[model samples]
Target: MLLVMTGIAAFPWPAATAQQKGGFRKLAPGVLTVIPPDKSSADELLHGDLLEVTEGLSGPPENLAWEPQRSPANTTLVERARNRSFARDIWCLEFAFKPPRMIEVDVPAADLKMQRKRVWYLVYRVKNTGGRRTVVDKDDPTKFKTETFETPVRFIPHFVLESLEPLSDAEELAKYRAYLDRVVPTAMEAIQRREDPRQRFYNSAEMVAKEIAFGEERWGVAVWTDVDPRIDFFSIYASGLTNSIRWRKRQGAVINPNDIPGSDMEVAMESLRLDFWLPAAGGNAAEQEMSVGYRGMFERMTLGSRVLEATGWPKTTKSNPAAALERMGLKWGDLLEPVGGGGPSMQPLEKVLTTIAGLKDPAIRTALVREMFGDVGEAALESLAAAAAGPVDTEQDKRRRAALQTMGLTPEQVAKDPYKSLARIVGAMDSQPGYAQRQAMAFKCFGPAGRRLEWLSKGAKAARALAAMESIAIDPNSVATGNAQTAFEAVRPSISALADEAERRKVLQGVFGPRGPDLFAAAVAVHEGIDHDWVFRYESDGPGL
Candidate 1:
């Protein structure tokens, strides 16, 4: 049992020769070693570490070798994996940067030279382990069964290094120390700025891999959450320069694919240092944040949700999600038991169903329904055939009559396949420019023409309501002022008649950004002929519905 403990106490070891594994030239007097998962004596990497230290690149005019000192802290074991396929228990190494020390790099402009120092170390390797677990089947009571499973324990660490130059001067050192006292927030903000764009909840790194240039150096860190359900914690650094230094994690997969040729993964990060000169007393110092955590973080990643803001999806009560279903006009009793015992208690309506039903324009809906659902939505339209025979009085009715007339179908032909007949009826109604005109006409209608559309067939009702919705422009203000009132009146009836309240509410949820359910209720009130007072009341209070 390799119990990988962590500590910062330094120790010395006997001199060793640099071992070579293809392009990974292992450093002598090594800090750590990696045994390949294959467990082959030929495949074992001798006394060395996993940093691809590149030197003598053309940019710096003169670049000296990064002479690595064995980090003062002993290598802490961050994870242990038993790969039965390789028949080996692999221990992943982690350690922190020793004290920051100076390195010399000559710059070209004006022969200017600056003393620079960096503290770089591998943090931890986030990994998912899979194996077969043998358990007695509770169902059979005495039967033993083996099940294969995978556990996702995502170990995410952010490496931060702050360096200020000219340590030879006591005043410069004092300024650097004082600056460290104030650099926490600034350093945090810098890290946040880089990570925010990449810090999304993705199961696999592949999702964001396209967002980043593969194998090219980037300035930010890439982040991913465990695809599986697990509680992951991150260390919160305290105010001091070394207030809380935890065990280091492996940077990431290697940067140069050629380095570890044919290896499935590479080091995730290449650089883990940030350098900033202290401000000249009152004047601010130029701070440069350097990072490598973004690279190789996406390898072997499973795709998952990319949640940027919790505000977008507010958590509702889970005790009775069925209540929400009831509110959506679906009876709780009607819902089939979820196939899995421990999933959501209520079966949510298919998004497509609500999308088809809540659409703001009948013409668009007709087109989409025909294209997307095809024969699938035919059953839902079965009941509408009877409505086609109902009296045609209002302009909405005349429009339906025009649609049926265009189909040129006899009553005998309509009765044989009611759903198909209804689909054809709507499809025919959609063929004319008058379909769109009537929708807009209903939107502008202040009298019975708009109100009477409620009695039309479900398809016509949905279309007319959608057309009204299209008429009103989105308004950010809660009060029904200016064009907001027109927009509200247009969508009011469509939303009210929608069987799915959540879908109804979503129509206004982000109509102009995060207005929430109140806007939906206000629209409903306008449709109900209550007008300004109720709409204002809904806006002032929360969504009363």
Candidate 2:
């Protein structure tokens, strides 16, 4: 009996094993299943908290009867609040995302034909970091209460891959292209193998309606195809991260008492907005910095260089106004304040030359030299010459100087002989490359006309012409007067000498002569079509986004 008992005790029962040994339910006798280990604590983590700190009760208020219908004679639809807003600080989750990558996969089309398509995908993980907060109970908005049990997070993610290239600063809506997250069944297996075969990846819709409980994590990939490969900068808006929103009355939206108050308000989801710049290189995004050095302080950024870099958005520290507004759940046009304060309060550019032509001002024919070099003077001449010489390097002269310095040229060489000094180092860009730095050096110095204009000492043209132009802008009707004819007559001759040859005759005929605003209009139009708002695009292979 003792030997039988000993044998019975020694017999291994998989079902009877403790969870510490294996799983709570064993798969086999004497063989226990081990769960994969968690990621190493030592691994460098990109930490982002999706928990929103919430305050203020938005949406329709409880007891919302602005006008109650007490009788059938005054029949009205009873309004129950559609849904009470959650007054809880949005529960934050730990979020990590992988930069978008290109993967060529055998995508089976609707026709069931095996077609290889290019796919771009962003991989991300969300881990629930559970916490309790004293929040407003939805049942009674008036009463503030605390809840012990944290609500299960249902992640219904909306991933939008918006091309920054399309919304390139008020670019017309027609050229604006954006792609929604796609459901590509074929790409998953391939992405899994490429990223990590062990971890299961969920698509946008696949990950929906599932509760990620405390300490639980879910991984998902936002997939897109047919995206423009030429995009230099783009933002992948990951919404549904938090349920909190900040709203304000939409500009020019009128509020109706019968409608929900929120309907009149424009709402912005609290989301992770990540901005990326892709250099000309195939697979990298560059970081933005003061490209022209602010000495070594901003030297953290390479001068005149663009290196694409990825950034995290969820840190809670007080940030710059732009990011802070976003963190506080604000979007563009929320407050509707004019940017840069409507610029300077300068008056309209006058039709002085036109008025002069209508009068056929004869006094101005005195001498071309006197009109060009005397009355208009050196200061105004310089302004006209610089303006005519096709937008001299006004903003980047410093950057060009720095570029020259980077090219082993002294400050004196950069100032006195920028053009030739820049030439000596043109080849050095490839040998010792700093693109932005080198590109800054590449900025051509002011031309001969521009150089000559500077000889007027600070007064590019004499002060009198400039004084007339400046003061004329002060009075709305100044251009329509006899003084306007004389003033314009004096400034007209200078354009022949100063304006770009392509537009000089046009200006001389239209703006300076009997052509009036017509030819001057054409002369000005010569520069109108140029997309001066330029970004020198470049590309690189790795160490990108």
TM-score on alpha carbons, each prediction:
0.17, 0.38
RMSD of each: 26.2, 24.4
**Backbone atom clashes (below 3 Å) for every candidate:** 21, 33
Q: Rate the local accuracy (lDDT) of all candidates.
A: 0.27, 0.40
Q: How close is candidate 2 to the true structure, as a TM-score?
A: 0.38
User: 116 in model 2: Cα distance from truth in Å?
Assistant: 2.7
Tens digit per residue, CA lDDT, model 1, 1-545: 11111121111212322321223223345222221111122111112222222311211433323333674223222111111111111221122221111112222233464322221112121222222334558899567555543221122333322221113211110111111111122233333343243332221222224222111111222222111111111111211111111222233433342344223222122122221122123322113221221111111010000011111111211112222233334432232222212211111223223544555666665555443323323333433444454344487555554445556764345566543454454343333344344344333221233322222232221222222233243221222233423433433444457677655544433221122243233223322221011001111222112
**Which digits, one per residue and each the tens of the lDDT, describe model 2 over residues 84-144?**
2332334545566655667788887789798887777877777665433355569997775
Worst 10 residues of 2 by lDDT: 303-312
Candidate 2's C-alpha runs over 4 A off are: 1-86, 108-112, 135-149, 166-176, 260-262, 282-545
